[model samples]
Target: MKNCDFAYYLSNFFTTYLPGHLNVSENTVYSYRDTFTRLLTYFKDERSVPPDKLKFSHFSRDSVEDFLKWLENTSHCGISTRNQRLAAIKSFFRYVQVEQPEYLMLCQSIISIRSKKSPKPTIQYLTGEEMKLLLEQPDTADRNGRRDLALLSLLYDSAARVQEICDLTVRNLRLTSPPVVRLNGKGRKIREVPLSAPCADILRKYMQERKLDRQDRMDEPLFFNSQGRNLTRSGVSFILAKYISKANAVSPHSLPSTITPHCIRYSKAMHLLESGVNLIYIRDFLGHESIETTQIYAKANPEKKRAAISKTCDDSSAPKMPDWNDNPDLMSFLKGL
Candidate 1:
């Protein structure tokens, strides 16, 4: 009815506060918008609170908790997804508290609700042999095959997110003495990742063939589909899946069934770590804000851990202690205790 209403504030929150004040990306804004859409849907279906009649007071701590539970139980969302929705709601309420201080207690209650703990996901990556098999799957003689080879090579070499690869323009490439590709990462952060000689060679040829090396075409996407548009995430995944299937057909265990573009990134990171690359450099390469995030690669690496353990001592020369159960004095002492 008035500008002070929940609908009014919600509208302004998306249109003004997120974009104007916070300067969040379009993707982020869309994600937040989706969360609110789901929230409204939950209210309508579960609580019988219609969209227009929904108020800020409807988002009480108990109601928010119930919605999260509904997401898991009824909606079949994972813990991470549930946490993400909660985070989005919390962010909105935080903005509301600043604008409408009268609802401070309610806002604080929702904010105080801790995120549910989710188990750390195992980082799936390709091994060197598996990577070799995958890279060889594409028929390099054909144009599309050459493109796929170049795409896979760059995907692994740059250790980029799928979105970063999608965002790549012709100008982002610099095939100089030390070739590098500029990756636009999350939070508007940019990082330059050095490409391997093979990767650079493939990219150089792909660009030359597509006329992307021309100054006029600098704004063009580095990789495109049959439609001459930049490859979407699903497009890239589809390409990978096709090759993965082929690779697996040849050697049944060459690649994992669940391999995605992200696995290529993880594979690259693992390869670098296995090669003794410093975590700091890996962090910068992967565009991670914290070294802790990069450390997951190191932690997940069992080979590195095994190598370290192997170097600690020679088992053959180590002194052996008597078995406690076989020693009469030790057994008597244990019985007394």
Candidate 2:
């Protein structure tokens, strides 16, 4: 007889039930699997026992507290990551409580472990000069350049995630006013995103260069590689990296390296928000299921944070921390770590 029931039940829930009932995308399934993996690893190390020996009977509110602490202190996870891991555990227990009543108390207790608020990550964006430099860096005069230009330009204009952008076909683009581009986004849902005029114009140039007679199979990929196959996700990243590195100073602490196709997505999101676009509109435009996800950008509003911080930081009245070098204790602690 096992001491706990999670091993047999939770495994089945994730492997079979979640897929069938949740209708989650493959990426989402993989992400949840990773969360369980991290959870199991934490359990084994923190409890001084192997994961297989861990049972629902062994789970406790104190253990849940330790699990959260482990996530922050030992695993060095951010608040969002820790919260997500807790969600995974909660969902697993929900499944367990339904199918395996022996673990009901354990499942219920973990719900008490409340998730904390995480600091919003700062958004880095490209300046106008930088964007112009990157767009011009690629030689649109050549065949490869034309293809790469279309690829990068689409990322910038659509503000699409790399995955959504890669799934694109020529048919998805409207090439007309509001220049509707059908975005096949996360969770297999589709949304039509209106393209800015600049994006539409750049895309028009690429299509003209391709000389497609409109007879080209409607299902064919919009962006193809040199060998005439669909361009890969990594290939797009590689192209962005090469150009950004060449066009910018390529510094250790600079926005150029960070400004990839995803940056273009972030750029559009921030630009729209700063322009006072409705949050609901931006949510639909980005094809995000949760408005909570879109709200991360509100906190990630770089210009506002910088301006607010700048004035306070420049204050002569603000007390400065002692230099690390001047503090022997601080220097000793740093060395110990």
Candidate 3:
């Protein structure tokens, strides 16, 4: 049997295009791959079309629309997740449109499928006092506690994604004057975030105790498990939850109901915003692709909004109006009405 054009283009799109040409991160490629996997499974299970026999002709706009509905209604995916799956499919069709002009109309229809709108999520973050309580949970007397302290501090201070923290190495840390840690952000974008003196101090002690300060160990994972491997995203979350639970037990009313590594990131950005840091700087600090992404911190801060309003308000500038009682003509008019 002749090889299908869909298989031919799809293979090159993943192997050659996404990694080599687009230079997307491995995680992004994996996410895109998962979208297609689910899509193929949908055809196999729902439409009775086997994977090996499937072709481009089977993927009409209506079929793709039905698959998206299947994702939301049947698979129980949220609006955000369904939209993400649609985005991946649209991206694939976009690449196909450029490669083969013959399927231009079909590709356009699939690519033009609008994503479902979802409500914006409320940003969760910790206040300064609550953050202090959480950070103090780690007992620095033990070796593991010291490592946890350093990990939590750096995670909060850098406003880094969990994956970025996992990808960190001794070489990424610059402990000298003007201390900074180089973060490998999405799309392989490298951003050097300055370290706070307190965080740097903790890291210095942790590195010395672990003997990671030696010249021979630059490439070693900064934070690792007992098996001597870099921590996974789940590992980072688990570490955070452990500390949060301890903090909550001690002062249950003070801390937020739920917390994650990403919440630590949100807390960092919120603190910076409250300190009157510029949105542009926060965007760069948080490794956001756009300042718009960082604006959520500003929008979520009610205190900042009050402060801005208070600054612009002036009681002395108020204009006085003639009293209604003093105006007999207005009073008479009112009575007539």
Candidate 4:
């Protein structure tokens, strides 16, 4: 079968538009690619239309909506995942509209399809004491244990995403005065996060032991597996889980039952907020595109909120309101109201 217009634009969207023009990250490209893959699967299995014969005429707003429903109902995807797939489809149509204006209305329809509302995920993090206890779980005497400690320390200290930690190279580290590690965040935005002295010292020692201090090894992965390959997300998670299990055993009910690499990042942010660090600084430190994203940390912190209220309540200058129960006239008035 001949290549249809849909296939033509779709190919260019992935190959040219996303990577070449927009310069999205590989993970983003893969996510967008998966959306189309699932879409084609939907067409082939449910609509009796094979990939080779599918055309733009067969791709409609209703068909896309049906595919989203299939994702939730048949595939058992959560609301967030379903919304992400919809976003990918919508992105494709946006590119389509730009390339071929004739499809503008159709593209707009797909774009206008709102994302399904999902409940806000509670931000899970560790307190300073809990984080310290978890960090102490790794055995520093063993080579692998030392490596795990360095990895976990940097992971928490920098408040970096798991992928950012995985992507770290020897060149990203600056083990000098005011030591910092440059993190490449989502969309390939680079931000340098200052590391704690202790964390930097650990990483410096770890790098030296691995012979990564050599000039030629600058491009090598900062943290690697036994196979000498960069640590995968699953690998990082496994390492964290091992320590978490040990920490839980040592101090029962101290840590969360389950902890992901992301929880470390949240822990750092919460620690900073509790220490009176500005939200804007936290936003930049976390490499968030908006303060709104960083605000979730503040909003999720009940301790900080309670402290602020307590401080306000303790203010000496504020006049206290007269108790209505102390006055019979005021009580009668309230009763009449």
* RMSD (CA, Å), each prediction: 3.0, 8.7, 4.2, 3.6
lDDT, candidate 1, 1-337, per-residue tens: 3523799889999999998998888778888988889989999999999999888767789999999999999989999999989989999999989998998999999999999898999999999989999999999889999999999999998999999999999999999879999998888888999988989999999889988899999998998988999999999999999999998788867678899999999999999999999999999999999999999999999998999889987989888655666766976757655
Q: Model 4 lDDT vs. the true structure? A: 0.92
Per-residue lDDT of model 3, residues 133-206, tens digit only: 99999999989999999999999999999999999999999988788999999989999999999899999999
Candidate 4 per-residue lDDT, tens place, 51-147, comes to: 9888888877899999999999999999999999998998889999988898888899889999989999999998888898988998988999999
Off by over 4 Å in 1: 1-4, 313-337
Deviating ranges (above 4 Å) for candidate 4:
1-3, 313-337
User: Looking at candidate 1, what is the lDDT of residue 304?
Assistant: 89
Q: What does the lDDT come to for candidate 1?
A: 0.91
For 63-156, candidate 2 gives per-residue lDDT tens digits of: 7778878889987988898888888777777777778677678778877678898765577766555666777768867888876777777787
Candidate 3 — which pairs collide? Answer: none
TM-score of each: 0.92, 0.72, 0.92, 0.92
Runs off by more than 4 Å, candidate 3: 1-3, 252-254, 314-337
Q: Which 10 successive residues of model 4 have the least lDDT summed?
A: 319-328
